[model samples]
Target: MGNCCRSPAAVAREDVKSSFSGHDNGKRDSSVAAKKAPVTVLAGVPKENIEEKYLLDRELGRGEFGVTYLCIDRGSKELLACKSISKRKLRSAIDVEDVRREVAIMRHLPMNNSIVSLREACEDDNAVHLVMELCEGGELFDRIVARGHYTERAAAAVTRTIVEVVQLCHKHGVIHRDLKPENFLFANKKENSSLKAIDFGLSIFFKPVQMRSNVVVLWPDVAAPL
Candidate 1:
């Protein structure tokens, strides 16, 4: 994931190649066109333009299949983040299923101060947009690098917060496969701002009877205190 705390002065755009192709004899193939149609990543979402509700501003970050932008609600003028995933990038059935599962898992989790909240989810003809609360304080990895070393109390507090987040996910039958300093962000730039887990792209719902080999782990190397 790209850093979301970068300056949003410049806007960025990504161009994707169209999957459809013209016939050899200058005629279009209707059947092939239908086969290459854009996949609907999210179900039950009305095909409404995302720009109608939120004004997408400068780009904040870019991932493999989507871009995160600084957005504002047109009605309330509240600042938020919009993560738009392009349907063209979801080439395979597994890729499409992963995107759908990500949205479902985020919505399935209960409200918590330690987890970033999803405001709304909208889908259009081209992409699926996820509107969420914006965290501007930057990633935990950067914070630790700047501070050089952490005090005993500060380290303990950080450890306790991370454990609580994991416990909460387990309670909800959701396992966050990716947990690291880069995945955690402070709510604001304040000294005592709450740290929140921001990404769930790799999370999945698990049952107690499931085999241990089904779990995926991406643990961080925490040789010393953060």
Candidate 2:
């Protein structure tokens, strides 16, 4: 099997094409390697020890900024999601303004049902890690694609929460320029399934009289004029 556990090579050669090829092999090796590989220790963070803070056992997802790991706090065994932004991107962006904005927003955003709870934010010399509650129910987009379409009642139920969240964001002078299914996550896996809005990468803040530019260009028709 290809190396499933993270290695210097996997981290260095992170790309979609190469990733799929290695995935199967990695999956085969997951169980054994998981027992052998020590969980990554988050730096400059509080709590008795970082290990007790989070136990990164699996790779949940990944993005341009970083990867999300399914972690469990040792003491409570409570599941959590930890996103680690790459060191390369930290220094890669010429402006580095977006990173600053994201961290600031996470720190300032109010805790409510409308958004994902930010448990902690930590940074070491190489990366910034944002720790949040784990949502096992999966992404809204995945559900939509799997089910094809929602019933009218289901659609309304989901849309109502989404609209409320968006309205709250706007009220706080923040604009979720990108509103899509993937960004919505299911909080409770069972009966009372709830949506927890995730990611603010494309979000921008604006005052009452201010207008923010849309960072996401869905298509040419809606693309901002250059």
Candidate 3:
């Protein structure tokens, strides 16, 4: 129970001892400690100041580990959504790996109208930022609830879009583990705005054979696994 049950003050002292252990003179190497302290969530992403490139506006949404902000590009003045995931909230190695996999999957997928495009991913000491296309319409679930129901044609259209997205993911050897209306968002507030699949936090890369075991049927009675 050395570190596991150590008090905050004891932990701080232990950290101080470890930091100066490398030096015979007992002086800590600030640069060495700084370089080794921060965790790297995304591989190959150079550390950059996110604020210099984008202005993080009002928060659009919040989840357990991160916040989605309305980000504006400083150079082109383009509107984008920035999902900033706090490093502090990444409580374990698995949490950090999940973020890395999500970013990798998004970058691996080909550009498609049915999927939200990730513009860029950057990180600093505090957080990992994912800049993606802004979908202002709203969640698909909310729209369905507000309208009470969808017309036969509208329902069919939505179904087709969702199927297409799933197909695209399977074609590229990726499986979106989480699929639901809440994860889909409309690109705009128009009546006929295109729906895009947004969240890939739970997605994973798989082999073609793995697809058979992972059955995803949008309509249980009528739909077959693709």
State which candidate has the highest lDDT. 3
Cα miss at 219, model 1 (Å)?
6.1
lDDT of 2 by residue, 1-226 (tens): 2223352123544642354466485454444443332222333353233333566666878877778877677778788888866554544343256665676676667887868988877654345667898888888888887888889999999989999998888777787666778778998666368788988766777888676454444535434576
- The reply for model 2, stretches above 4 Å from the true place, is 1-52, 92-95, 212-226
Worst 10 residues of 2 by lDDT: 1-10
Write the residue-wise lDDT of candidate 3 on 1-226 in tens digits. 0121222223345655776776467865667555447788888889887888887877778787778888889999999999888876788999999999999999999999999999999998778989999999999999999999999999999999999999999999998877888889999999999999988988889997665664553535333455
lDDT of 1 by residue, 1-110 (tens): 23433221122122322232344454445765444455677888877877778888778778888889898889999999988888767778998898898899899999
TM-score of every candidate relative to the true structure: 0.82, 0.72, 0.79
lDDT of model 1 at residue 164? 97
Ranking by lDDT: 3, 1, 2
Task: TM-score winner between 2 and 3, please give it.
Answer: 3
Ranked by lDDT, the better of candidates 2 and 3 is: 3
**Position 25, candidate 3: lDDT:** 78
